[model samples]
Target: MSVNENLAFDALSDRVRRQILSILGEGGELTVTEIAESVDMVGRSTVSSHLRILRTSGVVNERRDGRRRYYSLDTEGSVRDAFLFLQTILRGGVHFDVEATKSADVAGEIQQDVS
Candidate 1:
């Protein structure tokens, strides 16, 4: 994998980081304290560490407002590229198990419905 791709995967491998992303994906930028509150079991410092990794991987963007730092998803970044790469491979007819695909499709549909 390319450097950005590898970084993206590495950053995403942690469950805490994934939770942080999901919190950021809620459409608005937030502070470390806010993210830590939303993400169970972790503190502000832990959230900040995850945010740092996400920023390095180009999966999230950080903004400074004087003393405060806010974070949001980076829509046009390595994470997006990595997903697009996987999508292209899937579209190229390399299929997984039909049952697994069906389950995933159903889960996606449910998520969309919730959204």
Candidate 2:
């Protein structure tokens, strides 16, 4: 598969990663332990490993607060850029750009439309 397809599938493969994104949406930031606890699916180490993938992929941002690490989703702008990488393999050759990312200034635009 292409890089874009890889990213979306990678993001979707583990249930933990999807939940992590949800938690980040709520807390805006969470430590490794906190995330593990919130999901109750696996250990902190497991969550950390997933976080590593997300961090490396530029889907999530991390910051260290002393011994604790906090993570959150990249803003719409950032995620849009990442999602655009998958556009090439969207079952069509159509291209997507930053301007296409914007719909309304209203919050929950993505979540609302998707559901």
Candidate 3:
């Protein structure tokens, strides 16, 4: 994988970051406060840190609305590239057994759904 792809995957390696991405993927944009609420046990500063990493990785877009910043998935950037890269790998004769991975948590379950 390329460096950009590697960075994207690295950003996604953290469970908290993945949860943030899941919130963004669900629908409309959310402010930092709103995002903090959705994630368990994470404080504002921590969420901000995750958002910073995600923004730096190009997986998310940030919009300034007055005093607040709203974050959402970046449709045309690293997130797209990451998904495309995974698709390419899966299409190259790789096969997965979904039932075998079902007992894992939501993070692992996502791959089963994709498969």
Candidate 4:
């Protein structure tokens, strides 16, 4: 994997970071305070730290509006590239449909539960 992909994956390995990403995915651009409030347990400083990792990994974009800084997901960035790479590897270069993959995963989980 490339450096950007490695960083993206590393950044995503944390549960809090994933939660922050989910929040950003739904809310679009949000300030540090806003994100901290949305995310449980973590404070603004911790959220800022996670945001820094996300920014360095090219998974999130940061913009400053005077004293406040806003963060949002970078749609066409390393996270997307990393997932595409994973998809290619999993599909052995064949096409992979995200919705189908999700359904398969759910079915596999249900089968495991039933077993």
Candidate 5:
């Protein structure tokens, strides 16, 4: 797999990272304090680690404002590419009727009596 794909998947593998992404997805930029408070489990240092991974993964964009750094989603980043990959998987292969599977499942079931 490509570096971008690897980074995207690695960044997505952690619950903390996924939570951080969800918080950033809310819209505007947020500071480390805000992100930590939102996550409410990790410390500032831990959040910083997560932010560093996210930034390195190209999943988030950061900007310096005075003494604080603000973070937001990177629209054209690896995460977006990962999502597009999932979309491709969903659309690939021959089309099939899901209802047909239901009928097949019903036909394969064997009834049994239980006391």
Candidate 6:
């Protein structure tokens, strides 16, 4: 998978993927089994596929424990920076306080709040 531009947001566009990120971000690392249990899907394969896309986007990192694989967020700095850059380009003069919040922690959850 390519970690190209907008990959994180693009990957987040899907509900399941976003839920996966939210679960990982709010809690911490988890395996495909745990993630599958949270979402509508009941199969590990489905969760694994979503995790793969997130990992490719640099939005999640993975760690292995024995036969289990755990994944967590990886967009703490880069994500917030991207949103600030967008605000700068869109808002012009950039009056907003970019330092007010951390991007990694919010990620797709912010959009959920606004919508």
Instruction: Report the Cα RMSD per candidate.
Output: 8.3, 10.4, 9.2, 6.3, 4.3, 11.0
Candidate order (lDDT): 4, 1, 3, 5, 6, 2
Which pairs clash in model 2?
A: none
Colliding pairs, model 1: none
Q: Residues 23-77, candidate 3: write the lDDT tens digits.
A: 8888569999999988996998999999999999998999998999999988887
Give all candidates' CA lDDT scores.
0.88, 0.72, 0.87, 0.91, 0.86, 0.73
- What lDDT tens digits, residue by residue, belong to model 2 across residues 13-114? 778888888888898887887788897788888888998987776678899888778888876434456566665457353324333444343346767888
Highest-scoring model, lDDT: 4
TM-scores, all models, native as reference: 0.77, 0.60, 0.77, 0.77, 0.78, 0.64
Candidate 6: regions farther than 4 A off: 1-4, 76-81, 87-115
**Candidate 1 runs further than 4 Å off:** 92-115
TM-score of 1: 0.77
Better of 3 and 6 by TM-score: 3
The residue-by-residue lDDT of candidate 6 on 57-104, one tens digit each, is 777888999998888887663345555556667674343435334564
lDDT of 5 at 42: 87
Candidate 5 residue spans exceeding 4 A from truth: 93-115
Error of 6 at 38 (Å): 0.8
| lDDT of model 2, residue 6 | 68
C-alpha RMSD between model 6 and the true structure: 11.0
Better of 5 and 6 by TM-score: 5
- Clashing pairs for predicted structure model 4, backbone only: none
lDDT of 4 by residue, 63-105 (tens): 9999999999998889988888798788843444776788899
List the candidate 4 regions with Cα displacement exceeding 4 Å: 92-115
Question: Cα lDDT for residue 107, model 1?
Answer: 100
What lDDT score goes with residue 84 in model 2? 64
In candidate 6, residue 41 scores what lDDT? 45
Q: After superposition, how far is residue 25 of candidate 5 from its true place, in Å?
A: 0.6
